[model samples]
Target chain A: MLLEKLQSAVGAGVILPDGHETFVLNLGPQHPATHGVLRVKLTMDGEYILRAEPVPGYIHRMQEKMGENRSWSKYLPNTSRIDYLSAMTYTHAYVLVVERAAGIEVPPRAEYLRVITSELNRISSHLVWFGAFLLDLGGFTPLLYAFDDREKILDLLESVTGSRLTYCYYRFGGLCNDVDAEFLTGAREFVAYMRPRLAMYRQLVTDNIILRKRLEGIGRIDAELCRKYGATGPVIRGAGVANDVRRVEPYSVYPLLDFKIPVYSECDCMARYLVRMDEMEQSLRIVEQAIAQLPEGPVMGKVPRVVKVPAGDYYHAVEAARGRFAIRIVSDGKEIPYRIKLRTPSFSNLSLFEEASRGMMLPDALALMGSLDLVIPDIDR
Target chain B: MTPTLDELNQAFLRLLTPAPALGTACEMHDATSCEGKGVSPNPAPTPPPTSAPVPPCRIVEGKTKGYHFDADLAPDQIVPAGRLLDERGFAIDAVTGVDWLAAGQMEIVYDFYHPVSVLHVVLRCRVPREGAEVPTLSEVFPGANWHERETHDFFGIRFTGHPDLSPFLLPEDADYHPLRKDFTGAA
Candidate 1:
């Protein structure tokens, strides 16, 4: 009866035989390794995780339901809160979908501006992931180094976007305001300064023998598995699929600017780490290119006071720092949406953990989760 | 090489020909014309009186590059159509539900994309609001397990063959489907 109750508690898939003894560990709805309020019910055979199930939604705010009730313009603020780490991309995708549905035209300069700031936000997000992942693996110094670099990007973004973290800058057709020349120069200097600093990161963390051993050959998720699980961003690229939404389904000014989609076929935690590391450089490149090609035009598009989407279903996807962030809006020719869904990247990326972490050591499982770079609120949203 | 929108439409048409007995309904059209015409060649049978008027299925062209194919399928056709896309190497990007309370129907949306060809397809299917159920795509695309569960959590739509239909992104004991139009958070 006790065994049956345990089986019922954490799904039958993780159940042990009648006589065998295995410990079921609850690893956080409030634990540091999880990075947020994410709980993992691990069925362990000694230190090896036989099955891992993640229980999310501690932060669920019903953002989608909130979207339906609020007017089209009123819902803009909620987008950033969906994924605070890459708030710009979330807000950008939300605006793009609404623009597509309402037939609003964004100015060329605004498109370029969106690209620059969004890419900078991507770099900052990757920096956070790097720091948090290393911190999870017991390296205290790299988190400090990663934050120092991230702070520079944040300062650059904050000058224009207003709020540093959960940005609500991107407007319906364009941006809330235009960026200044000082911001451009700071961004350019940061790019030049970051290239060598990345090389130093390779030397400090990437070359560290202990870090290498901890990541290499751990959490091997191949190309097919990634596709099967809808894993995106560095996780899919690390598995050798160059499936970045920026390249796959070109949006904003991504097609105009050129950058490589970093793919490391190793399919391990190290490969994901390297992909993020390489992607920060590529994001820097995109930002540099956008600033060079910056055009002079109005930042905000000439949008009508009352925003109404034609009765239809519209979808838009953007490449966020973690993966593909998509917004699907079902509009009913009114200011308020009939239904709204935010297809967040962290939700799908974290879904793969249960399958990927099975049969792995507990510490390696944490390493795998860290490499996936989940923001639990994003998953909950 | 990427298949043109016409070829993609034909592929879906083939999958739904002589539609199965689950009251399967579908409509096929040229992607560009669907945007302007606002009409389907053969609309689905009139929905039951209790259900709202069904919007004619549309196969509109995607505005963005690489987002080529868009179609509306009946509840039963989703799995077979999904299987064909899975075989063609389209990864399931997301599965979500739209609660059309006025129409008395729940629409399920699935987005898929080809890795190499970069062909994005949006498939939508609708069921009555009272007993919303659609065939699960989890078997066709294993990654859809969570997406379907989340859809279940928000809209209370059931994916017929889903392995695990437990609450996802919601507390286990929560009784309300928060995303439904009728849910006013009064509990």
Candidate 2:
């Protein structure tokens, strides 16, 4: 019966035609559409997916488990790995939760530094999302185009944080290094430099009707449905819900930066595209503001050589490029956290795919998955 | 002055803000304490040090003392933290289940954010170790279904009314809450 059900889902036959009835296909642990080591077992009826079941844990590093072993300070690195593309945002969530629990007041200058770097990280993330989203849609050119500008932001971040991908630059109190005046000036110049490029992105992708036909209404997540599933980032905003972690709960220098959280109410794939495209521009503006008012101060707070957060729970969320990133940390009066739980935005956002994809074509489903903009590690974690 | 989450919390307490069950969380403290992410409050009056220590309770029957957070909702409590979080403008980020073997018991943590409030609220409900169960919030927040499913998958806890309780990020019959202290199982 199980085999028959699987076969029917595959749609070849409830009974075998040539000994074997089902067209079982594994859309793999490495397939581009699988989004990084995700294996979705698809029992198919020709090109149509009859049954699609997701398989996770291929790269399950057990970050939450690792938090139990490492102290609060030692576990920050783990955040970067969950959604490596949005590492800084993950670490920001980690540090902020500690700050809230322990009452560590991050100074004004520190907040500006955080904003400059985080916004740059946001730009870097969106650039990748933009490129990758397009790449998924079958146009490979935009990937490289998005990366060119992303390199600039990456270089700027590398100057301060020292590493590109899994940066452990943020301390509970401040940054690991100060923002040099030259770096500050360069960051300011870069944002000013990238202004028109964003408009170009709109023309190249956002305004393209062909792209719209592929995305526009392909994955229509209604406003009520979005909230029901706890979607965030552009997915929720696209549904006409004005909910952004940065705007709703202002953190760092965001309250001072004077940038609007872009929200589009269309609740479709195209709406998500527009929301993300507009957000990158808003991120640039925030980065510019931070560099303009870049106050002079020590980048690292007066933290002891070995950082130790006191006992009790600390939960903090950051507006990652994708959505709200909530980190719940419990320290056992040690350097590491007794327990650390990451509430990744991508995981929840991706769930909408199940509802949004029902009764949709395979291409439409892919479009819906792409539009959700989730990184699997974030989901698996 | 732009208000922060800390200021909001203080105002909530002063105005007798009903201890609703959810709020937003942030990674960085914005401008000042007022704008940081959601933080569970300590019962003590004074703010604790960054490295403040909590003594681990002696292992009583292989478990620590479980604390109950029964924050009674006032009858006219207009903003029941849980309902408002899903009804109007809030976006649920992630739901967390905190299992404290050292302190004992488990805390079901819900993080919520309203774009305009500029406030993040964290609501945590507690359940004991032997039979941990909570009402499914999936009926309220569709996103909670995934979170609740993942929590059920990893922690091996049951959400009594969860519509679908299959393993989301785990193998169908895998038996291990990898996040639990005694977990060694995997898919």
Best by TM-score: 1
lDDT of 2 by residue, A318-359 (tens): 789888787766665666566677878877787766666655
* lDDT tens readout by residue for model 1, A1-381: 996796666544533576545678899988989988999999887688888998998988888888988899999999999899999999999999989888899999999998998999999999999999999999898889889999999998889877889889999989888999999999999999999999999999999999999999999998788887888989999999898999988889899998999999999999999999999999999999999999998988889999888866778889999999888887657679877878888988988899999899999999999999999889998
True contacts kept of each: 0.48, 0.46
Worst 10 residues of 2 chain A by lDDT: A13-22
For the record, the alpha-carbon RMSD of candidate 1 to the native fold, in angstroms, is: 4.7
Query: What is the DockQ for all candidates, taken in turn?
Result: 0.42, 0.24
Q: Which candidate is the best by lDDT?
A: 1
**What's the TM-score of chain B for every model shown?**
0.77, 0.57
Residues B21-48 of candidate 1 have per-residue lDDT tens digits of 3234432222112233332333444434
lDDT for residue A225 in candidate 2, whole number 0-100: 72
Query: Model 1 - which docking category?
Result: acceptable
lDDT of 2 at B66: 14
